[model samples]
Target: MPPSGGSPVEPPSGSEGGVMLSDVMGRDRSINLFAGFLRDIETAFRRLEDSSQNTTVLAPLNSAVEKLPRKPWEDPQDYGALGPNAYEGGEGRERAQQNLRKFVEAHMVPLSPWAEGEKVRPIGGDRELWWEERDGAKLIQPDAIEVVGIAGEVANGQVWIIKGVCHLT
Candidate 1:
């Protein structure tokens, strides 16, 4: 387990001896959107688990999802005549999954024990994110979003539940 600004907590069970991303997000009840995102990328998470390098994930909670620009696939009407579940299989599913993978990757930085005042590039996007401490509160990409609560460590990395989705501008 990673330090949470204090003593380390016990790692959650079923984490393959490493802290899983789902376990970290599970601790925060408000991170439903991020949890869903993780579910959509189960394969990616598995790959992350297999890697030896440490990673840092910047996850957006429910409120952050609400603030983000809506994606066409998120709306049932956007599914056209095929229905919402149309994206569940076939080429559409592949494309949608690819997009989701990119979105999730954009929020992840390949570093562990990320510190304050560090500018890091995301794994899926070109823009750089910085860790900022304002008024004694820790924040990542202060110009883009706010950190909701304390950071938690998982088996391979740290998780920061952020308040808003970040976009590459």
Candidate 2:
């Protein structure tokens, strides 16, 4: 006769009490991608600041620190033609600008990682995301990169986690 207990379950392949590739690639990309996205936002902010003078208040986002090797604006790949919802001409261009603004607003939000204390939450999604603590300091589990630590608040300004590198996403 079969055993009275419930059937045994098999653990996932290549992940036996160890970190999975998904863990390494997934969440890490989110940070990197967001950093890239921030470049455009910063540029837009700079433009606004120039026009508004000192009257406009602009708090710099953490993503501002990221030095993007290449910018999408510089690319002549013709993203407009690539997608079905391409923006062409004056009205289309305006729509595209507005769309970008909305994206920034939704993703670049104020986050207080220090104030909350331990377990930093990701801004991109509802899922709970946090950094593991080690010896009273937060250990940055930056996928395969092995980021030892980072000073200042990791919270704030559109934090997200995605599978694989920014290019893949």
Candidate 3:
């Protein structure tokens, strides 16, 4: 967990040598709300095994969850009350999983080590994302959410911890 009432954690400079995306996300409490998204990313990586295609993950922190619109398939009553695992092993669970996978994929790109100020399209291909650098901090666009940290050297690619959700517009 980050220190209370202080600036967000900054991503380490350069690759830290083969850190899995799951491990990276697990260590950060700020983005714990994105557990569902992280799991979906892991699922995607498993599906694409042995593929050398690197990826850039845009991981949203807890606050971003509040910004996302409720999905039609989601149970409105359980929206914020449920965790990613809550959607497992039940009727419509498969659909929920699929939806989650699509959501995570939409925010990812098949490019690693994405530099600051580079404009690239997400895997979803619905909109473009700009990796803007501001005051030595990296941000992903639509809302200029700062990347608080980064975990590199994962099996598939890298994970970037963004301050908020990247709402598709």
Candidate 4:
């Protein structure tokens, strides 16, 4: 488990080692860090919309903003459709996809129905995810959106990094 700032808080003596203090803190920090990244992504989306130059990479970002089901909720297909067009070359496409995956993962909001008690799965399938709690707040980690060797990256005002990847069901 990663350190969660400041001095480490040693566990109380004589307690069962069911869960480590570091684990809990790491989860909490991961959630907060991801949330901050999501906030930045939302702003980036807005800037993409405001831009006038219509580039290939801008297309997917625009579509994502338009098709985002709701605030903090988005479908993975939106990123898939953008494909290589989201980036300039092979490397660019990979970066774009990585970025988009990061954006969605960071921004993914827990559905009330699912968050109530049930274990939530990824939109497409059983992709491993990270769950974190910070100050009693919960956060979900984003899944990797990739096709082959290409990864996604966030560039400029758009989530313009991707390769023709599929999220296996």
Looking at model 1, report the run of 10 residues with the lowest lDDT sum. Answer: 1-10
Which candidate model has the greater TM-score, 3 or 4? 3
Q: How close is candidate 2 to the true structure, as a TM-score?
A: 0.29
lDDT of 1 by residue, 45-119 (tens): 654554366778787887777776665124344367566665664655665666667677877887877877788
Identify the candidate with maximal TM-score: 1
Instruction: Estimate the TM-score for candidate 4.
Output: 0.23
Location of the lowest summed lDDT over 10 successive residues in candidate 3: 1-10
Off by over 4 Å in 4: 1-32, 43-110, 113-117, 123-125, 128-169
Q: Which ranges of candidate 3 are over 4 A from the true structure? A: 1-19, 40-43, 47-51, 66-92, 151-156
lDDT of candidate 4 over 23-130, digit per residue (tens): 221222213332233333433322223323211121122233434453222234534776534344564444544554444443222231222224454333354444
Considering TM-score, which of the candidate structures 1 and 3 is the better prediction for this target? 1
Each prediction's TM-score versus the true structure: 0.71, 0.29, 0.63, 0.23
Instruction: Spell out the clash pairs found in candidate 1.
Output: 19-155
The root-mean-square deviation over C-alpha atoms between each candidate and the true structure, in angstroms, is 8.4, 20.7, 9.3, 18.4
Give the alpha carbon lDDT tens digit for every residue of 104-130 in model 3.
676677677677677788775577788
lDDT of each: 0.64, 0.31, 0.59, 0.31
Q: Is candidate 2 or candidate 3 better by lDDT?
A: 3
lDDT of 3 at 108: 77
